[model samples]
Target: MRNRLVFSAFSAAAVLAVVWPFLFGGQLAWRDMLVLDYPQMTASNFGGGDLFARNAPQDGFLSIIAVVMPATWVVKALMVASAVGAATGAWWLSNKELLPTLSAIALAVANPFVIERLLQGHWSVVIAAWLLPLIAAAALNGRALLVWLLVFVASLTPTGALVGITVALVCMNKHRLVTLGLGVLYLLPWAIPGIIATFRGGQDMNPLAAAQAFAPRAEEAVGTLGALLGLGGIWNADAVPDSRHLGFALFGLGVFACVLLGIRSVPKRLIVLALVGMGIAIFAWLAPAAMAWALEHIPGAGLFRDSQKLLILALPAYVAAI
Candidate 1:
């Protein structure tokens, strides 16, 4: 009962964190939500359009829901659900005593990566991020089939798919070949479109220039560094709320102290995840030259135009590791 209460509190907090900013006017006038997609989605032949033809299947699925329900309600529900789901998933994955689980849940659901994504109105990525912990839990339990299905759902977004693959690779220690095969099979729907798009070659930008453009700013480097410790980092100045820098600093300090006190208890994989996430972020932000070289020479490195998306994977890993 106590555990349940703790989980409930964390879930409520998570939902509120995401929804609080929009509660004032109860408006659904945000970025993609206010676009023509809402009307297009409400139409019976929503998915038949070219806009959705190349889009992730998840978009179509959401459109179907919108067709029957109020669009505003659907969008609001999903936003809240994403936060609660993330908190719940993190709580389950922690598998620790109350204090650690609570800490992990707080860090996981309230971080900068999530806040930034929410602000950007990337619902698919948000949903995928929320599902990651559940998928990881399934993988750790050797529920190979369940993990594959969850990964398939997550793969509807490219970033989510990448994180799914990482989690599967990390957790599916047994029957590795079978897990790999399942992953390939489930990812085909999303992968096929991306593959075709890549070959079709749209507007090509200088890889280094793209990286430098999207990389975290130097002034916000502290937040990005704090993100390595499970705080938030939002690169866009307009998107950041007041006092966020101070919040990031406090969160980072708290996490640092926790790590120092519980270093031995931390999972090795989490340390590895932090290093990998930080390395990718730093390379894109500070070493754009090398990233550009990779983009120029490597066939698919350009997929990571916004290399900061790698932090999505790191956030969940940070929670589970805690």
Candidate 2:
């Protein structure tokens, strides 16, 4: 009980340290994150026309909560809540020693992946990330309902859903059919509507063009490999920290090496998961022609255009191994 209280205090402090300004200062909005005093849900938010349902349930969800609180506060609350929630999840994953627990908390809530996405205003993805480790733990315990419930929350965005499903498959290989069914059901809100919109009203964001435009990029001279090694290769250069271009960017390579060496009783499937994630993260950049071809030929492939989110698949491995 004492340790739990200590962790809770530490986690809250950690979250407030990073996001206190956004909560108390001027309106906190950036990139895709828009803030309005009152956000209303409309027909378009459901799906159809030139728009994809990427922000489907997210916008609708906020609209519902905004009825009781301001949208700015809603978003701020989300950031703080998700970060602290992630730390709690990390505590469960760690060895439960003080030092290891704190280290896992730091890596889970304050790492480059969280930073880049937070700076990019991807609160939805951040929420999914907080749920990642929890989902895996539930799966290992054979908690089917918990797994599906977590995946449903994560699926508010397509990328979040994909990584959640990938983790689910890795952890719960027993009930493949049931897992797949629940996954499809969770994704139906965005996936089905997205396909319908593409066929009927044309695309607002062209997948082939988006594939080329949003390919993984380098932070500096070390190139995309360096950026991704640090778990911070967001296509939007402005979303990344300026320090990412510095000489220390290669520091993550050390973490990667340590993680590989540290693997012991962790599932071998986690390594495969990490490799598959890296492959997807680099796919568009390394094979532009193939990426373009798939984007053109495959329906609803736009979801993969911003491929970096797939890196979340590797995160569980990193957490468990380290």
Best by lDDT: 2
- List model 1 lDDT by residue over 1-322, tens digit each: 8888877876787668666764443445455334222444532232232222234555555566666764456555555665666787677677658888888787667666666666766666776777776677677778888777777767756577777877777876676687677767655655665555556664556776776776664323354555544445445555554555545445565675675566555456655765686678766776878888887777557656567767666665667766
In Å, residue 101's CA in model 1 sits off its true spot by 2.2
Please provide, for model 2 over 165-252, each residue's C-alpha lDDT reduced to its tens digit, 9 standing for 90 to 100: 8788778857868889888887777777777877676645465677778888787656787677667688888888777766556766
The all-Cα superposition gives candidate 2 an RMSD in Å to the true structure of 2.6
Q: State the TM-score for model 1.
A: 0.79
Clashes of each: 1, 0
Clashing pairs in 2: none
Where model 2 places Cα greater than 4 Å from the true spot, the runs are 1-6, 25-28, 67-74, 173-178, 204-209
TM-score of each: 0.79, 0.88
